[model samples]
Target chain A: MTSIRRRQVIAGLAMAPFISRYPLASKILGRLVIIGGGFAGATLARFAKALEPRLGVTLIEARSRYTACPMSNLVLAGERELNQQTFDYKALAEAGVQVIQDYAVDVDGAQQRVILQGGERVEYDRLVLAPGVQLNFDQLSGYSRQGAQDMPHAWQAGAQTTLLRRQLQAMPDDGLAIISVPPAPYRCPPGPYERASLMASYFKQAKPKARILILDSNDRFSKQALFQQGWQDLYGDTIRWQSASNDGRVNRVEPASMRVHTDFDTYQPDVANIIPPQQAGDIAHRAGVTDSSGWCPVESVSFESNRQPNIHVIGDAAIAAPMPKSAFAANAQAKVCAIALVRLFRGIRPEPTVLANTCYSYLKPGHAISIAGAYRTDNGEFSAIAAASGASPIDATQALRQQEAAHAADWFSAIIQETFG
Target chain B: MGRYHAILPMLVLGLTPCGYAQGAPSALSQSASQAAVCSGCHGKLSGVAVPALVSDARVLEQQMLALRQEGGDSAMHRLIHAYDETQIRGIAEALASQKNPPAAQSTGP
Candidate 1:
C-alpha cells in the first residue's frame, strides 16, 4: 500500500510538465462533480484528484454504502456474505473527494448545477454521471418495484440479494428455481448464468434434487461455449438454459403466485429471479443525456455526453458498445475518462486510449471460466480488437479451471481495493 | 524462439515512435495513464493468485511480448495482444519505475 501511494505521487509529479505546458492550468481551480458513487464515479473521483490535486472533486451518491454486484451471486449460493460485497466511500473521502450522501434529483445543464433530493444546488465546472443502470421494471409487463419484493431481481446486490437468498433457502429439496434474463446491453452480461451455476452448486450439496432453469431473452450470452461445457461437465442435468429463439423471453411475472410467463409456457417455479431490462439512471434522462434507446451516448475517447456538453457519462449508463457493462469495464472506462478530463482541463487533446475488459464467471466452487477483450476508438466508436479478444478454451483442464477461479477471487479483491480500499 | 521471435521485427517496424522513445518523461506520463487500467486487477497489494505488477521494465516487456505471441485463450494472453512493442515498453517502464517498498513480498501461486 505504501508503494501504491508512492506510485500515485509519482503519477502526480509526472503531470507537472503537462501542467507547465499550459500556464493557466497551474492556476486552474476547477470543480469536478460526479454523480453516483459506484465503481465508475468513485474511481473517477479518486483518480481525478490524484492526477490533479487542485481540482475540487465531489462525488454524490444516494446510498451511504455501495453493494457491489460483481460477486453477489456467491452470496445467493451461501458461498459468500452480503457484507463482503458492501463498501463505503470513506477511502474516497479520505483521498480528498467530497463524498456527498444525497440523491441527485436533477441536473440543470444550462446552469451547470446538480439539484439534490435534499433541495440543494451544487455547481460544477464539469459534471459526470456514472449512475450505472436503472432497472426498467416497466419493460417487463406486470413487474414493478412492489412486485420485485415477492420475486426478487437481486440485480442491485443488497436487500434484493438477501431476499433472493432467503427464498432459495426456503425452497423445498425438489423445488425448481427460475432465473429470467433480460436482453443484451444490460449490466453484467454473464451474471445471471453465473447465478444459475452457483445456485446449482449450492443445491448439489443442500438440495441435490433441486434444479435451475435459465430463461434468457438473448439468443446467446457471454462465454456461452465455456459455460455450457462447464455446466455439462460439473452440474449435468441440474441446470437447464433456454434461449430467446426457443420462447425463452419472459414477458410477464405473476409475483403473487411466483410464476414467470414466457411466450410458449408459464413456469410456476418455487423461486423466481427476474432481472428486468435496464436503461441509464433517472438522472441521465433528467440531464437530457440519454437518447431514445434509454442509454447515454458519449464520445468514445473522453466519454463526453453527445447530447450535453461538459457532462460525461461512464459505466453502464454510457452506450459504450463492444464493452460489456462489467465492473472491470467500468473501472477501465473511469480511468480513461479521468485521464481525458485531466488533459482536457489542461487544454491538451486526450490521447488515443486502449480500453480492456476481463470478466470471470464461476461455474461452481473452485471452477470458473473467463472472457477478455481490448477495445479502441475506431471511426468515433468503440470497437473490439479482434486479435486480442477471446474466451477461455472449452477443453481447458480442471487445474486450469481452478486457477481461473482463483484469478476470479483475486480479481474481485483487487478491484474492490482499487475502487474503495 | 520460433514464430514468436519472427514477429518481433514487424512489431518493431510498426511501433509509434513519438511518445515511446526510451526514458522519455512524456512517455512515462502517457503510459502511467494507460497503466491505470491494469490496477483494476493487478493491484499493488498482491493477491493469492494474481501477482503484484512490480517488475523490471525489460522483464515485464519480455513477458508481455511473449504472451502476445503465444496466442492462447488465457486472459493474459488475450489482453497482452492489444499492445504493440512500443506501448508495451512504455507501460513496462512506467510500472517498473514505481518505488516498491522494501518489505513487499513476492509469492507464486
Candidate 2:
C-alpha cells in the first residue's frame, strides 16, 4: 500500500506456542483472519503463528507478491530492480498462514467473516485489515485509472515502478519532470520528498540539464530542513520545490497537456506524476470504518475502529496522528495489536498502549535526518507521549548522517526479520 | 494484598513535579530516567501485542521483572538493572499510573 508520493508501510507479528493438548485443548479459541498481506498483515500472521501453532491464521492478499513501499523509490530511480523491493508470499505461507490470493471485498467485522469479491467468506474470531490505501485520482481532473496507464502512479509497487522508471528514462535530456505532492495526513509523509531526492540521484547523472520539480500543496513538510539542504548541495540548480508560499500549490491538472494548475497559472511538462488527495480504501468505507474526515478513528490505544467493535485497523489507513503514518509507526502499532490479541486469547485484560515512531529520510548520498516521537492514549485520543521524546537535531554531520543511514538499514533488516521472513 | 504492599512505597516516594535529585531532575530520578530509557525500546505500550501499563501497579511490576529476567543479559539492562529495588518499583509505579491509548483510534472499520 504505497503511492508514488505516499508509500504505505505495514508491519505484522505472530507468536505461536504449541500445547500438549491437556483434554480441553480442543475448546481453544476460534480462528484469526488478517486482510491485506502487506507488512502489517504478514508480520501479524507470523507472530500469531509463533504464539500459537494451532491457532488458525488466514491471510487475504490481493496479489501473490509484496512489493514493499519502503524502498520502492530506489526502483523508480533505477538504483534497484523491482525484485529488490519484491517479496513473495511463499515465506509467509510456509509459516502456516492460510494465504489467499484473492481480493477481500467486504469485511463483516461484526460477524468476523471476510467476504471476498468472488462471494467467498472466511470466518474469524479476530480480524485485522491493512488494505493499505487507495489513490484519490478525483482530486486532479483527467487522471483516471486508464490515464495511469500512460502515466504510471507506481504508488502500489511492482510493475508501476517499472513503468514510472521507463517514463523517466524516455524523457529528453533537458526535459521537465513535474510531480505534484498532495497535502498532509498522507502515508509516508516524507516519501514525496525522498522520491524527489532519489529522482535527482538519477537525473543528475543521466539528464544533467533535466529539472525535477516538486509542486507541494503545503508550506511545511516532514524533514524540511534536510530536504532543502540536500537539494541545495546535491542537485544545486537542477532540482526545485514550489511550496504554498510561492503560490505553487497545485489545484488541478489536465492529463492531455501534461499540464498542472497551481494558484497562479498552468505549466506543462514532458512527464507528470500527479499524486492526488488520498482517503482510506473503499472496503473500509463499505464496512462503516471511517469518520467524517475520511479517515478511521479507533480507541487510540488498540487501533480498534471506533466504528466497529471487533475489527482492528493498522497502517496508513488509521488516523494515528501525533505519530505520522510511516512504516515504523505501523510496525510499532502491529506489535501492540499482536500483544493485545494474545492477551485476549487468554481472557486477560489489556493494558494501555504507548507507541513510538522514528522516521529517517536522506536528502542524498550520506546525508540523513529524522523526526522521533512517543505517543500514548490520553483522554481517549492518541497524543505525543511527551516532548522529552525529541526530534533528531538538524544539519547533522556526514558521519552522524551516515550512522543514521546505517541504523536505518539495520532497523529495516531487524524489522523485516521480526515481522516477515 | 501483595500488590498493595508493592505499591505502598509510592505514597512515600515523594517524587515532586520536577527534579528531586541533583544530576537528574528531582521529578525524574535515576529510576525515572531509567524507565524512560527502557521505554525507548520496549515501550511500544501497544494494547494489542504489547500491553498498556494502564493503572495497574502490580501487573506493571510483575511485567517489568519478568521481562527483565526473561532475557538474560538483555541490552535493556542499563535501565532495568541500573536501579535498586525501590527505584525499579518507582519506574513501574509511574508506568502503571499511565493510561493505555490506541496508537490510532482507526475510525474506519
Candidate 3:
C-alpha cells in the first residue's frame, strides 16, 4: 500500500472497534429515590428528570399538598392568600417522577430500598432527603400539640397560619399580642423576625393601639436592622422587641389560658405565637443518618451525609452552612447535590460546586430588605466565600426598599416556579 | 478517526451489555453476556465513588434521574449531562443486575 493509504488503513483498524462499541450504551444507568416533597425534593426531581428521561425517579411526600413556608406568614398579615403558597404533585408527574403521597417509614440503605408507611417497598440506587424541619416543642415546657391549636406558631405554613389569622382578627382595639421567637440555628433564621415585622404593619392600621410584644430567646436575630427600621417607621412605639435579658422575655406559654410571662409580669393576650426549637425530622435520624446533635452531618460541599453513602441530605435536615435555613439555600444545595449524583453515575469526577443564596424580607407594600451570600466547597467544607455578603442597610431609603422589594418578589417567584411549578 | 475514540466509550457504555468488549464490542443478547459487562466495572474501590451499581436495576434508574440536572444535583452535573436518556437508563439496568459486595465504601454524603 502507498504510505498515505497505509496510515489511513491503520487508523481505520483502530476506528473499527469504536464504531462497533457506540451502539451498546443504553441500559446501564442507576436510579434515584428522593424523600420529602418540599423545595429540595421537588426541585431535584424536576432537574434530574429533565436531564435524563430514563432515570427512574420516585418522590415520596408525607403530605398531599405543599404549602410554602417562605410566604406563609403573609397569610396572617393578609398580604397573600393560603392558595398562593400551596402546590400539588402534578409538576413532579409532568417531569416523569412517580409521586407517592405516602410517608416514608424506613430507609433500609443496606437493602437499597425504602419501606413506606403503607408497607410498600420501593428500591433506589441513590437517596436524597429533604424531609425539612422537626419542631422541638418538647424542648419548651408547657408546649404541646394540643396547645398549638389555641396558640398557633404559624410555623408550618398551612392551618397554623389560618388559625393565627383568625385569632388576630378576633382581637379588639388596644388588645395585647405576643410572639415568641425561637433560639438560633432553626429553619428560616429570619422567619420569626419577619413575622413580627409583618404583624406590626398589620396592627398599625386595624387596631393602632394593639401592642405587639416580641419575646425573643436570643439577643441577635435575622434581618435585625431592616425589621427594626420597619417597625420604627411603620408601627413606632406600638411594637416592642424584648431580648433574653429584657424583663418581658418569654419563658413559656400557657396556651389554654392565652397567657405568656417573664420574670416580673404576666400578660393574658388575645393571641400568642409560640414558635419552638427545631431539629432534623424523624425520618433522617431514624435512618441513622444523623449524629447526637439532632442534625444530619454531611460532607459540606457535596452535601452528602457522613452516616451513609448513596444517601444525600439537603434542606433543613442537613447541616449546610454558612447558608441560613431558607428555601433559597435548599434550592442551591439541590443543584450541587444533583451534579454529585450524576458524576458518580457516569464514572467521572465532579467539578467543585459553588452555590449562592439571597433572602429578602418584605416590610410593606413596596418596602423590602435583603441579605445575599455565595458559597463553595474548599478542603471538603462548604463555607461562605463572599466576604461582602450581608443584609441591605438598616435605614434604607424608600427608593432602595422599593427596588429590593421588586427584586425580592421576582427572586421568590422564580425560585418557587423552579421548585414546584 | 482517533478523535472519535473519546466519544465512542460513551456510545458503547451501556449499549449492548455491561462488559461485552473483551476484544472489541459485540451484541450481547443473553442476560449472561449482560451480566458479564455489569461485573466488569462495579464494586471494590470502583472508579465511580457512588454506591456500587451492583446490578440493582431499580436503584440505578432513580440515581440516574437524581444526577441528571441541577435540582437533581450539581456534583455530577456535567458528566451526567453528557449521556442521552436511553444510555443513562441502560446503564442503570445493566449495572443493577450485578451482585454488589455486602457494603461498598463511599466518600460523600
Off by over 4 Å in 2: A1-27, B1-109
Question: Chain A of candidate 1 scores what in TM-score?
Answer: 0.93
Local error of candidate 3 at A120, Å? 1.5
Among all candidates shown, the one with the greatest DockQ? 1
Reference-based lDDT, residue A306, model 3: 92
For model 1 the local lDDT of residue A292 reads 97
lDDT of 2: 0.62
lDDT rank order: 1, 3, 2
Tens-digit lDDT track of model 3 for B1-109:
2212222122123211223334332222122222111111111111222333334455555555554542311112223443456645554554444332211222111
Better of 1 and 2 by TM-score: 1
Candidate 3: deviation at residue A230, Å? 2.3
Interface RMSD of each: 7.1, 13.7, 18.6
State candidate 3's DockQ: 0.02
RMSD of each: 7.8, 12.4, 18.2
**What range of 10 consecutive residues in model 3 chain A has the weakest lDDT sum?**
A16-25
What class would a CAPRI assessor give candidate 1's docking? acceptable
Task: For each of the candidates, give the backbone clash count.
Answer: 0, 67, 54
Chain A TM-score values, per prediction: 0.93, 0.89, 0.90
lDDT string, candidate 1, A1-421, tens digits? 1111222334666543211111235455677989988889988888787667778788888777888998888888898889988888887878778777778899989988888764566778789999989999999999999999999999998899999999999999999999999998899933998999999999999999999999999999888888888788888999999999999999999999888999989889999999999999999999999999999999998899999999999999999989999888988888888888888877788877788899999998778889899998646799999988998888888887876787677567656666785
